[model samples]
Each structure stands twice: as structure tokens, then as C-alpha cells.
Target: MWQRGAVTDSAPLDVDLALLGGGGAASLVLAALDRHGVRGLRIAVVDPVRRRGQDRTWAFWGHPGSDLDPLLSASWQRVEVATPARRRVLELAPLRYAMLRSGPVYDRAAEAERRLGAIRIGAPAAAVHDDGDRVVVRTGGDGPTVRADWVLDSRPRPPARPGRTTWLQHFRGWWLESDRPVFDPDRAVLMDFRTPQPRRGVSFGYVLPVSDRYALVEYTEFGPELLTDAGYDAALTGYRDLLGLPGDGLRVREVENGVIPMTDAPFPARPTPRVVRLGTAGGATRPSTGFTFSAMYRQADQVARALAAGRAPVPAPAYPRRHRWMDAVALRALDRGSVGGPEFFDRLFDRNPPERVLRFLDGTTSPAEEVAVMNSTRLRPMIAATAGDAAHRVRDRLRPTRPAPAIPAAVVATPTPPPGTGNRST
Candidate 1:
């Protein structure tokens, strides 16, 4: 391994891991390293801006005894889903629909930095190159460089998006506090598809209540592009009107908005094995649902175990090949409007237990259970979608892979992928 030149001391400094970007994926990797008791290894987290605020909320259905147990800000044991004509309620016993604020996560991450003793270089890295045994990271212009035995390139994203199929899960949410008790604090609305949908995509509203008077009201859609500022406001207004939420002496406390990519582009690209790509960059994000939190955690733990075994971390495919193939079938069908999102999801929840459906969406379903879920969907449409998917894959394979142009150091970062959802959506 290449070592840094001596400056203040005689011993050389060589980082065991150089995190290309210090977002959630990189943070989780450090936590995994600490969990596995891999100490005395130099580590560096490179990013320009420190994660700030509780501006984003990450919601997931998790066990009460899991790693996120202590970090939960709010949770609901009973969940509800609705369409214009039908509604269903589900009871989650050991698993609860939970939420964690970004504020607490960032605070705990600070503690990780202190405990793990990682070097935080608050600068943007322009390029990451794998040099056989070591990966050299260079900053723009005259900035310093660091070489590490292994590099996990989790930089926000490549400059050019090359997805033959890309759908965005875009949403805007308002945190509301009411003077009177208006929401059921014990229950959360996973999806209310009673609102008007777009001409091309499905739309829904989700509510997560913190208390009887406080809840998060979100308007979401799976569409081709992100809505305009005014477009989002109009949609939120319409949904608020549909639910009569703006009245009843209610006030908006805080607001947040974000867009998540639901693409069948193999989640960007797979580069070298030595310089492995991380999280969504490595196709960890499920294309059909745009969920990555659970997958990222699993992948980080896997990488740590591989390294602890005195071997290079070769992260297995986050989703099995069959799952990826199935997702591609769904993506093409949805993008072409051959399938309706609401109808498909309603059937999925209606046919299988929510827990089973959730496991399937999380990519943890057994082969038999997966078969049952697939049986619930209309097979003819899937067959058609699969044919198109095959053609797209062929074209994508034929296309040449070009290296990304150099990113100027002045550019800080790209849009960060939003947090995972609590719903068992497909």
C-alpha cells in the first residue's frame, strides 16, 4: 500500500478507507467498522458540507430492538392505506412504522467521528482513481491528496445520468401542529390515493403523526421529472383541500421537499472491484421502490465483514439478479403506462400479508414467497414488459462506457438521494 510522506512524525499515514463522499452511506460504513471492532485503521471522510438540520425525515418499518431503536422520534403500531373506494388497516406487532430525524442522526454521527477517530477533510474530491494496490483521491487545483488501500466511491452521482428508464419519486411535505386533536397518533396513513393523480403517473398522500395535534402531511408522485415549485405547491394544496387539513385551526410548523430516482439504469455504474461504488451508485437502490436505507446498512455490514476476514470487500449484489430482473420488468411497464401504479400496489397489499409484502419490497423474500407475490400480479403484462426490458438491456450493453469529465472543485456536490420510505410500496 502507498503511504503518505512524513510531515510531523516518522510514521507514515495511510487511510484504510477513503470515503469519497461522507453522506449517509459513508457514515454507516464507519459505524459498521466500529461495530466490527476494526480499530487502529486510518479512515478519512471527505465531503464539503456537513449534514445539517432535521430538514429530512427517514421513515422505515423496523424492529423495536434494532440499531435504530434509540434514535426513533416517533412511531406507529397501526397503519392505514386507502384508495378512493377501499381502505385497509394493518397491525405490525414486533415491527413498528418508525421515523428518525436527521438532527439526531447527525449528532450521533459526530459521536462516531470522535470514537472512530476518522479524519474529516471538509473539502470536495474531484476524482478517485484506483492504482492497482491503492486508490489515489485528488482534490481540485492545488489541494492536498490522499491515497488509501481501498476507496469506496460514494460521491453524490455521476454528472450525466444514463438511465434508459428513470422515474422520480418526488414529494413535498408539511409538518403541521393543530390547536385541537385532529389526527390519530396511534395510527399512520401509509398511502391515501384519494387525491387526483397526474395524466402519466400515480399520486398519493401519506401522514405520520407525532401526536394528536402534530403530523406530517406529504404529497408524493412517481413521475418522469420533478415538479416545479409552483406545481408542487398546487398539488399539496389540492391534497390538503381533499383532506380538509388546512382548516380546523391548524398551522404549518415546517416544510420539506425532495426527489428520489427510481431508475433501471443499474443504479448508475459498477466501476472497479478495488474501488467499489457504494449505495445507490453501486445499484443498491431498488429501482421499483427507490428504497436504500436498509440495503445500505446491510451492504456496509457485508463490506466490513469481508475486510475483517483479511480479504478485499467484494459486496455481493444488494438485490439478487432475479430481483433486479423483476424490477426492470416493472420499471418498463410503469414508464410506458402499461401498468397503473395504484392498481398494482393495491393488489400487492391486498393479496399478501403486509409483512410478507414488506419483505418482498425489502428484497428479503424467500423464493416461494416471491413466487406467490408474482402470481398476484397479471402475468401477461409482465411478459410484455419483460420483452421490452430485454431489448433495452441489449441497447444499454451496446453503448460505450465513457469516463465522466473532471468535476471542478468549486462544485460542492450533487443532489443527495432522499431517505427511505416507511411504506411497503413496490
Candidate 2:
């Protein structure tokens, strides 16, 4: 528990790097720094809240040999996907779908921090400024202005409004334990699109069962607006009824809820010379699938490598240009109603081998494998999204460009972010 303190600015504490927000991304960096045994560098991670519990769950399909793989809670060899008219079960050979709870991973990072000696502050960063040689970050409530050689801001981006070229993968889930054995402990439902669809968006349900009687089930939407609490409750009720998990016999244990930005809006990893955006804000989340863990892990390695080499870090993207291009295309199609989620997903799964599709989604496919996956998609959405992208590029080329107005030093002010400013689900 944290308490409000007197707004007194303290003396400067110097460090090699300061992580603005201590969440999964910061933890990954701490773990990496520890693994590399990088010495003579001080580090600190500051966040207002203690990021405890299973705040979120991340699922991905991979070969599972990373340092974090040992923290995996559950994995499945076979996964199922359903549409209104079709059901498909994919057997993932060489790669399996896996889940990791945040608790153990958080604990592991805590252990790693013993080496780096990074402090996690319980306050929001008010503002960050690149002061030529170093970046100065001021926290709210007159908290000590943390100065470091570099800053990585993992704060969630602002909310989306009308007129943005973005979609949201919003979800609400319940962890349930049933009196009767009602779940397949060995399998996971990738997506069940039998749920009632919104007027203009796609919706689905997922089930990850840990036991015959325990599972985390949720309804998700890739749409314009997030579902209300009541709406999510109704969807969950329908899913339970469909699965024949009775109301009286089922006990809801806990709930998880979040919204992830699905966009191609230019998210430059570095917003300032001394500060680099990390995690989802830095474009780690896959725009199409809303996955982030694997991408963030790759990014951590990139940043750690640059620091070890004693070079100014210009972290490479976790995705290739082609991967980003395809992501933009898919998002555009979904936004334009040219793509229906159930059918779009079904086509990819039904036409391509599961490994190939997973590889494509993971952004690890070769050019040839990419071509094969593109061949499986509906051509109309591809054409539409491609045309839109081309038009935007041409418009930019033809239009006049101007430099951004500079902020005068006399009038500069950095406001404290409201609590949980950059908060987003992984």
C-alpha cells in the first residue's frame, strides 16, 4: 500500500537508465540485463502501483525455448476454432500454444532485480524532457525528478476516439470453477465465433481450461466500441449456457478485463532522442492478433544488446516491414467492413497449415511462406486496404509538409499523467 506524501523534490539520483513505468516490459528488461551479467550500470523502474496478481494473461504460439518459457502455466498441443457454420481443430506440431500467468513472471523479475538494483517507484511520471545529454523525468506530486542517460516509457497510449484508423480488441473474462467436470483440460478454444455479433463488428469467445472444472473464459470484440459491463455479462451467461455449465454449479472466481489498440497509426518506437517507447506503446502488440509477450521479449533483447555494446540504441522492430504492411491491410479491411472476423480467421486456419499461419502471425515466416499465407486471404480486402495505403502515401507525397512549431522554453510545462495513463492489456 502506498500513501500520499509531501510534494518535496529530492536530490538527484544518477543512473545509466530509468524505466518510467514498471510493468511487464520493464521486468523483461531487468531479466535480460541480469541474464547478460551487464556490470557497472545502475537502473531503476518506477510505477505508482505494485503490478501484482494476474493482472493479465498472455497467450501465444511458439517453439517455447525462451528464458521465460519455464514460467508457462499451461500449454496445448491442439486448439479449436469455430465459426457459425464450421469448426476446425488444429494440431500444432513443433510449436504449441502456451499461456503464462503474470504472477510467476513478476516474481522472477523481482529475483533478477537483485543484480541491477533498480528501484520501483510508486508514482506517475509527470513529464520527460531530453536535456541534450540526458533525459530528465519528473514524477507527480513533486516526486524526485529522476535523471538518467535514457528513459523507456511503457505507459499506455491515450484512448481512441472517433475518426482514428484503429480497432480495439477489448475483452472481459471470468475465471470459473464448476462443480461438474465440464472442460477439456488439455485443449484450448482459440475462438468460438458462435456468439452474437455486433451490428458492424466481429465478436468471439475463448476458453482456456486448466482442469476439468476450472477455466478462464471470455468474450472478445474487434470493433469500434468496447462492450459495456452488462453486455459482457450477457455474453458470458450465454457462453455458460451453451457449454451446459449450470448457474448454480458454477462459481465465478475472478475477472479480467482490458482493451488493446489494434492500429497502424505510426507508432515510432522513439519519440525523443533520449527516450524510447517500449512495450505496446512502442508497437510491440500485433495489430491483427493483439499479442505482445513474444514481441516485447524480442525487443528487450534488442535494447539489452545495444546497451551491452556501448552504443546508442536504435532498437530494431520486432516485426518486418512486410509484417507491418500486412497488419495495416488487415486492420483497414476490418475497419471498412470488407473483412468479417470469423470468415477471415477461418480462411487462414482452413487453407494454410497451422504452423505456417502461426509463423505468419508471429512475424517469423520467410518471404515464400508469407506469399503462401497471402494467397489464402480473401483478395478483395487486400486490394481495398492496399489501395487505401497507396492513396495515403501519394497524398503525403503530393501535399506540402511543414516543420512542427517549437515549444518555447519559457512556456514549457509538463503535466502529470492521470493515474494509469498508459495502462493497456498485454
lDDT of 1 by residue, 72-155 (tens): 778887899889879899887766788777666666666676677777666678877776888887765444587788888776
Candidate 2 segments exceeding 4 Å error: 1-9, 158-164, 396-426
Write candidate 2's Cα lDDT for 1-426 as tens digits: 222211233655566788877788877887887787766776767678666657667788888576767888788989999988987888998898988877777787777776666665567898888976999888876467778998887777542222125677788777788888989988899999998888877899999998899988888888768777678788888987876677777776767777776766555688778888878877787878878878888888888888888976557887898898888788888878887888888999998999999988988899999888888889977898889977866675676653322111101011222333422222
User: Model 1, which residues run further than 4 Å from truth?
Assistant: 1-13, 159-161, 246-248, 268-270, 395-426
Clashing pairs in 2: 155-422, 156-422
Global local distance difference test of model 2: 0.76
Which prediction has the highest lDDT against the true structure?
A: 2
Residue 21 CA error for candidate 2 (Å)? 0.3
Residue 45, candidate 1: Cα error in Å is: 1.0
Worst 10 residues of 1 by lDDT: 406-415
- Clashes found in each candidate (C-alpha, N, C closer than 3 A): 0, 2
